[model samples]
Target chain A: MISQIAFVLVLAAAIYFIQKRFGRIRKNINLGKNRDFKDQVDKRLNNVLLVAFGQKKMFKRLIPAVLHLMIYVGFLVINLEVLEFMIDGFAGTHRIFAPFLGGFYTILMNVFEFLAIAVLVSCVFFLLRRNITKVPRFFNAEMKGWPRLDGNLILFTEIILMIAILTMNATDQLLQPISDHYPTTGELFFSSLLMPLFAGLNESTLIVIERFAWWFHIVGILGFTIYITYSKHLHIILAFPNTYFAKVEPKGHVNNMPVVTNEVKSMLGLVSAESSAPPTEPGRFGAKDINDLTWNNLLAAYTCTECGRCTSECPANITGKKLSPRKIMMDTRDRLEDVGNSLEKGGPGLNDGKSLLGDYITKEEINACTNCNACVEACPVLINPLEIITELRRYVAMEESGSPASWNSMYQNIETNFAPWKFSPSDRFNWAEEKK
Target chain B: MNIVTMAEFAAKGESPEILFWVGCAGSFDDRYKRVTRAFASILNSLDVKFAVLGTEETCTGDPARRAGNEFLFQMQAMNNIQVLNGYGIKKIVTACPHCFNTLKNEYPELGGNYEVIHHSTFLQQLIDSGRLKFEGGAYKGKKITYHDSCFLGRANDVYEAPRALLIALDADLIEMKRSRKTGLCCGAGGGQMFKEPENGKKDINVERTEEALETGASTIAVGCPFCMTMMSDGVKNKEREQDVKVKDIAELIAEAKGLS
Candidate 1:
């Protein structure tokens, strides 16, 4: 009875903290400008299924895809067993479903055991890839500190959690015959291999080990749930919504600024009858901080798992440029968190003086992007680093008139000559007269 | 070769079936001029009634928008839309993917809408309809590789049209390791052609050219004039200008049909 109350208290605490942190995150995301992604219901659902559920883009890198699939599938299926553990914790019953499920319970336990072993093996391989082999994507400049540690920590936790499950099952099998409280769950196929080691232990000692393993496994899971809210692993939950709201237009199409369009229409005397009134006060031209970006952009930043697939595939990054698309998303999330923290303390909020540009992301990094959409195409979750880059660039060009001199000259030539070059417009058809 | 203008078509109280949008590169760049003439020659031979926008045509503001000058972009877009709408243009074709993308995708929002087609797709249609035929072409069985223009391939999803045209030439179309949706940029997009690239280990064109050369194909086929200049400069940088040649798809098709 005492143990069950402790379990209830711990579970309630986990739920309370998870809710508080998630609420804070949602508030931070809402600080950005609103844009409607509610259109095209069918297409968005399809994207959620294919990109998020089906793991379609993950298959681009075949080896990692297969390994990740094992963990992803294993982890999800094992959580079903965790659900039973939760019920057993509340009711103080051992294998409560065993009586109702009867023979079917044995099959389910075997499948769960097989998946746990797969999870353990995959996690070990993942840890080696990150630490020993040191995959280039995992070791990029942005991945130096917490990002790297966070990755390895998640893998390590999964390995420990899997071992706890196997240990609990093995010890429980020995206690089933001696303790009336422990039900017969049949011999779990994978954990039975380890029963030989615990077979000679006294009944009291085996009961203690089983109970201890149960507590460790459930507590570890609760801790992981809270930790992910603060880690890059939040992608496991955000990927679905992020992929659902992904841009449905062609990859090359950059959205037109409606405010600029209005001003230009009035200037050219081309305004329609209804919109002919003077344009509203022109606000900031483009994104200088988190507030200027759309909510979807913020969602993307949080959804990014620092996979660096985008950076590895980026032409600018590959050619040793300062631009790393993965870094862009990471910086956005970091800055957003900073802003969120400041706001929570009743501070200056967005006006904390520092901004996304110049402070978090550099001018050289945004300039290096070719807008090739390679990063967009490469993203597994449909996050668009290119959109944020362009928005920042727009802020620099329009708000500050800080474009490079060569680009300013090109803009001038286009203004005067109706072309980027200084050549006359009358000469546009001269190529037709050239005798080839 | 005589090329008609939109003004001439309007003066005769008639309209051509298509308006050939001769972009800034096709108008000004010396190398790309030959591509313009080659496409024009093919159109003339096929007797497809087409009119050039000529001097009335202007930059589509693709560079301006990409460089983050939305004000300049909207201005250029509005001005061009006025002229295009004035002509009541129903269909348009261009050899430049950048111009095609802007005219097709961006212009519609500003009330400029038309059936915009890239020359690669335009030529493919001509071939598909049997309007253009080839006989024992110059590139017959020659291993030629096609570099995807980002604007054409990923921007608009027009990957198959260009490749289909190459196949019609009786040429062996070898693909680069990164082609179609995953194709690399030629270091000239997003207004990079107008300025130098940011500090990097190597230029993007040099990297892309190395991939093209790795295929061991003698000729590199391109659809965009920007890619043409970049790939040609890359081959020159590698000092393989004599051994390897960069030819636009239009020029290749023109040569295949004995039109140029």
Candidate 2:
């Protein structure tokens, strides 16, 4: 009964933590009206059947993929042991999987045990890889503290799990107490070889020891859950949801730009019937701030794994420009949070009620972008960096005539001359005559 | 009254010899003179009688359209379309991708719908049908890399037609790794042709031109007048004017026909 209570308690706790984390995600989104908000949830269901559960991106790097699969499946199998520990501990009979799992399960459990051991060993190698190669952002940055904690927790969980499995299998052999549900004489490879050591053991004493092993497994999993919720291991669960909402098609297409309403100074172009016409300004492009960016833009920032894949691919970054795609995402989050916090703390008098674009993000940073979708495309997870940057540009050029002098002249030319350079339209045929 | 596409225009009704809407780039820019001249020659070689829209041509306003200036683009597009309609010209061919894109794609929103073709595509059709023939070229040793104008490659899907023309003209086709749909900007889209590029690494065209040079090709071939000017400036900057050439596909065909 005590074991049953533990099972109920943990299941409730998992649900609770999951709900709490999701609430924060929802709160941020609902806080503001996003410009072009695509319904990500509906798309998510379609994506999973087509993309995620299909294991597409992981398999893109095929050589190491099989190993990742091994580790992934290992967690799933051990989860069965976790449930059984809870169930049997409540009923005072902890060998829940033995009878129904069958003679095949005898062999299956052995294989499951062996795989757990294999994955655990591989994870150690993964840990060492982190230490030796030490990828700058992924393994060594601010996220490092959580990974270090979670990595050891997973390692410990695996070690403790394997030990419990071995101990359970050895119960009959060592004459320790346990249920008869587990085949004592000859089961799978390990159990069969060791059963002889407990050949003379009686039933009741054996049952007692089995219950102890169940408790160890339950506690190990609970510890892992708490660690996972707070660590980089969080991606294990979060990546699925994040990937589901990932942008699939090109976001920079003229089709994808959100039509801004011309209400009280909105949008770069396309006036609503209600908006009053304003005089033309030229050479103005890009966003000035965080709110100036679209809601999808904020999602991109929040969803970024900070793996620096985008930073590596950026031409501007490679050429020693101040732009780092990784930092671009972080800075969006930081600036928004900073402003939000200040506002929350009642800091008065803001800068034009404008966004992170002109006020915080400089023209150079925005201009440095080629609007190439490379950074967006290269991301393993879907992050559309260009759209957010472009929207910011639209705000800068349209709202303020603070465009560069050349564009100022050019915009003037386009306005007066009807071409970007203000060249004479009469000259159109002059070219044909010159060829004569 | 003409709402037909190129394929339709090629198939049915009266064949239009000169749906000639001289684009603003062709009209205003001087280096583009060779562009319209070559186009005229290609039309003459095909024995197609065409009337020039002359002064009837105004800016198609693609620059204003893309720069988020809707009112100006609409004003310009409607004005040009009304002039073309006044000439009773249903089919139009342009040497400029900007005008072609604006009239074909964007003008409809402003109540102007007409078929427009870039000169490469129009010329390719003439060569394919055997009306226009470039028997051989006197030009030699110039390895050419074709730079795709954004209006042609991305806004429209006209990637291969120009390359096919270049191949038929016996020009060595060296490709920049980022050609076709992934083509680098000529630093001239989003109405940026008229404005200066924001302070960034190098000018987008210079970077793109470098990509052309990296292919070890001397002559950078282009389909649009805007690309012609930008790539020409890049070649001049690299001081490769003597060794490397920037020629429009029209200019290339002109050389092949010994007309220039």
Candidate 3:
């Protein structure tokens, strides 16, 4: 009776929270124009196959990826057995699961337990690798991003699931009498391995122990349920939607039609399309602050796992430029936190009064980006740091008259010589005339 | 003769089969003109009497506009549009991919639109129409690879046209590990051709040149003048200039089939 109730409570919580977050994600993706819908669908299917299933980008470092995938895949597989156990506990039936594959699920469950042991060994190796690499504190190297809260929540969730499996197995062995007609079947991989020592325990003693395991296992899963909703690890649900909505092509191609307008304008302050007054500078084409950016930009930052894969692939970061694409996403996420915290306390939004490119990031970061797609390409879940980076540069130059001195010099040369070099305009067709 | 975008030029009264605009690159750079002249020979051999805008061809102002110097770009584009209206010339073509992209895509925004074709695309079409035939001659058995220029490849999706031209000439096409749409920039897009590459691990063209050498191709084939110029400099800096050759697509085709 205790087990059945526990099953209903945990499963109910997981479903409810997952669906709630999924709704937020769906609303965010619908913000853009409908032109890219077919393209988005094609890319989404590709992302599910590549990023989610194949673990394509995760293999940049092999051993840890193997360890991580083991833990990941194990979590997926062992949970099936978990569901079966939960249903059996609630319904008062040992045969609640394993009916589908002609006794095949019984063998599959045992096989998976053996695999779970291997996954645990890989997790130990993963822990060692991170320690050696000094990438500790999974959220941020410093206290700049998602906070230690999210990592702890994820780690805690994993630990709960692991302990639940071990504790439930131990209790079952301790109270073999509860096994009764099923003989607490040595069919389980780990349980059978240790049953030799417990073969002589009394039925009553075994029954009491079974109760302890049943309680501990159910509570572990329920606690993790609540924490998942409020953490950066929410990508466990959002990553799918985020990847599905990722752009299939390059980001630099601007549409022939301009879409943004001055929202603050009233009356005849703004006439539409080639009016004699001439379109009052079109209110910041790139971005100045969080408000100027799209909702998907914020969503992209929120979905970041802080894997540092973005930083690794950034051309600017590699060349010792001040820009770390990982930090760009992390800073945006932090800005949301810092701003969100302030707003909760009735404070200002992100960037307050300063421009994002100049104050939050730097001119050094802006000029350093090669506008290469490396960071976007390397991102596992499709985060494009260059969009906001370039857009900010565009805003600073167009809106603020903040051209780089070198670029301006080249621009002047282009005006005079018809080429960027210091040649005379009279020489423009000299080579062709000489040829003819 | 006068220069304008393919769109505005098309409004002209002339019904010429082809209108050739020898871009400023063709006018100023020796190697660029060589490539253009070679391309011109191919077009003429196919019995096409193409008009050359000559001194009347004003700058497309792509560099100025992309560099955020909109005022200057407008001035140059308007001047060219006026000149083309005087030509009564409609059909248009360009050997320089940047000129081709500017005329076909950017000019529409400036109201100087017309039907524009890159020389490789025009030459390939002429070949497909069976209007031109190769004058067979001695060939070099060298490994050759093509570098896709940003304007030609990404901006306009013109990757296959140049490669198809090379294939017709029977040049060995060794694929770079990074080619097609994902091809790396030659550090020459967005008016960088007029400016130095002050960012990235190194100049992008130098990195691209390293990628080209990795292909072990004896010669690097180029469809865009900017890519050809940059890659040539890159090959020299890498100290493999003697081993790695850079040739324009037209030059390679002209030499291979002895069309020139």
Candidate 4:
């Protein structure tokens, strides 16, 4: 009875903390400007199914795809066993579904046990890939501090959690005959392999081990649930919404600014300028910071898992340029966090003086992007780092008039000559006029 | 061979079947001019009845828009749309993927809409409809590789049309390790063609050219004029200009048809 109450108290505390952290994230994401992703209901849902649920993009790399699949499938299936733990915690019953499920309970436990081992093995491989083997993607400049530690931390946590579940099952099978609370669902196939090691242990000692493992496994899961909100592992939840709201248009299309259109129309005499009323607050031309970006962009920043698939595939980064798409997403997230923290403290918020452009992301980084959409195509969760880069470029060009001199001249040539070069429009057909 | 203008078609109370959008590169770039002529020659031979926008044509503002000068982009877009809409143009084709992408996708939102097709797809369609036929296998069994233009490939999902044209040339179409959707940029897009690339270990075109050379193909087929210049420059950088020829798909098709 005491243990059951302790379990309920722990579960309540985990839920409260998880909800609070998630609420903070929701508020932070809402700070950005609004853009409608409400159109194309069917297509959005299809994206969620294929990109996020089916893991379609991950299959581009065969080896990592297979390894990730093992962990993904294992995490999903093993959680079914965790559901039973939740019920058993509340009811103070061992294997609560065992009586109703009868023989099926044994089959389910075996599958969960098999998956726990699979999860354990995959986690170990991932840890080695990050630490020992030092995959280039995992060792990029952005992955230096917390991002690197965060990657390894998740893997280690999964390994420990998997071991705890396996140990709990192995000891429970042994204690089934002696303790009434330990129901006999029949021998679990994977856990039975470990029966030889616990064979000579006393019944009381076996019971204590079984009880301790159960508490550890459940408590570890609750802790992980809370930790995920604060970690890059948040993608496990955000990937669904991120993929759903992904841009459905052709990758080549950059959205036109309607504000610029209106201003140009008035200048062209197509539409009369609004009577010079007392000047309203001036609107920002482009994203000077997170608040000027669309909510979709903010969602993308949070959804990024610091996966360097984008950086690895980036032509600019591949050629040793300062632009890393993964770093762009990370920097955006970090700056957003700073803004969010300031706002929570009732501070100046966006006017905190420092901005996303100069403080976090550098001018050189944004300029180096070719706007090739390689990063957009490479993202597993449909994060469009190119969009954010362009927005920052927009800020640089329009807001600051800070384009490189060569580009300014190119813009000038286009304005005067109707082309980037200083050729006459009459000479446009000269190539055709040339004699064969 | 005479090329007609859209103004001439409109003055004659007629509209050509399609308007050939001779982009800035197709008009000004010396090397790309040959590609422009090659495509025009094919259209003339096939009796496709196409008209060029000629002097009335202007930049599509792709560079302006990409460089973040939205004001300049809108001005250019609106001006071009007025001229295009004035003629009541129904269909358009261009050899430049950047122009094709802008006219097809970007122009529609600014009230300039037409059936825009890249030359690769345009040529492929001509072949598919039996309007285009090869006279001699000029590139027959010659190892050729197609370099995907970023705007054409991932930007607009045009991987097959260019490859299909190369296949029709009776050429052995070899692929680089990175091709199609995963294809690398030729260091020229987003106004990069107009300026130097930001500091980097090596130019993007050099990296892409190395991949093309790795394939050991004699001819590098391209769809975009920007890619043509970049790849040609890359080959020149490697001093393999004598052996490795970078030609537009239309130029290859024109050669195969004995039109150029």
Please give each candidate's TM-score.
0.98, 0.69, 0.73, 0.98
Question: Cα deviation in Å at residue A101, candidate 1?
Answer: 1.0
Better of 1 and 4 by DockQ: 1
Better of 1 and 2 by lDDT: 1
TM-score of candidate 1 restricted to chain B? 0.99
**Residue lDDT tens for model 4, A1-436:** 9988999899999999999888888898998888888789899899999999899999998877878888888977888888899999999888889989989998888888888888888888888888898889998888988999899899999998888887888888888888887778788887788788788899999988888888998999989989988789989889999999889989999987877777777677777446433344547888889988898899999999987999999999999999999999998899888888888889887788999999999988888888789889989899999888889889989999998888899899999999998888778889987865
Summarize candidate 1's per-residue lDDT along B1-260 as a digit string, tens digits: 78999999999999998999989999999999999999999999999999998889999999989999999999999999999999899999999999999999989998999999999999888988989888776678799999999999888998999899889887888999999989999988888888899998999999999999999899999999999999999999999999999999999888877778
- Model 1 misplacement above 4 A: none
On a 0 to 100 scale, what is the lDDT of residue A427 in model 2? 51
Off by over 4 Å in 2: A1-4, A32-252, A255-294, A307-313, A324-328, A335-354, A376-382, B1-23, B47-142, B148-159, B169-172, B177-207, B224-230
The digit string of per-residue lDDT tens for model 2 on A1-436 reads: 6657766786678668667655544444344335443666677676655444555555644644566666777776757665665566557563556667667656766776677666766666655655666644344233445436655666566666766666676664454234344544335465556567556657766656655665566666665666554333554555555566665432334322213222212333435555555544422234565544555566556555555666655555544455666667766755655555455556641343655664556777655665445466456555666665555555555667544566567656755666666667555445644524
**Model 3, TM vs. native:** 0.73
Query: Which candidate should be chosen as best, given DockQ against the real structure?
Result: 1
User: What TM-score does candidate 2 get on C-alpha atoms?
Assistant: 0.69
Task: Indicate the residue-level lDDT of A202 in model 2.
Answer: 72
Better of 2 and 3 by lDDT: 3
Chain B TM-scores of the candidates: 0.99, 0.90, 0.89, 0.98
Better of 1 and 3 by TM-score: 1
Candidate 1 lands at a TM-score of 0.98
Candidate 4 residues B1-260, lDDT tens each?
59999888888999898899989999998999999999999999999999998888999999988988888888999999999999998899999999999999999998898999999899899999999887667778899998999999999999999999888888999999999989999989888888889898999999999999999999999999999999999999999999999999988888877778
All candidates: DockQ: 0.84, 0.22, 0.20, 0.82
Alpha-carbon lDDT of model 3: 0.64
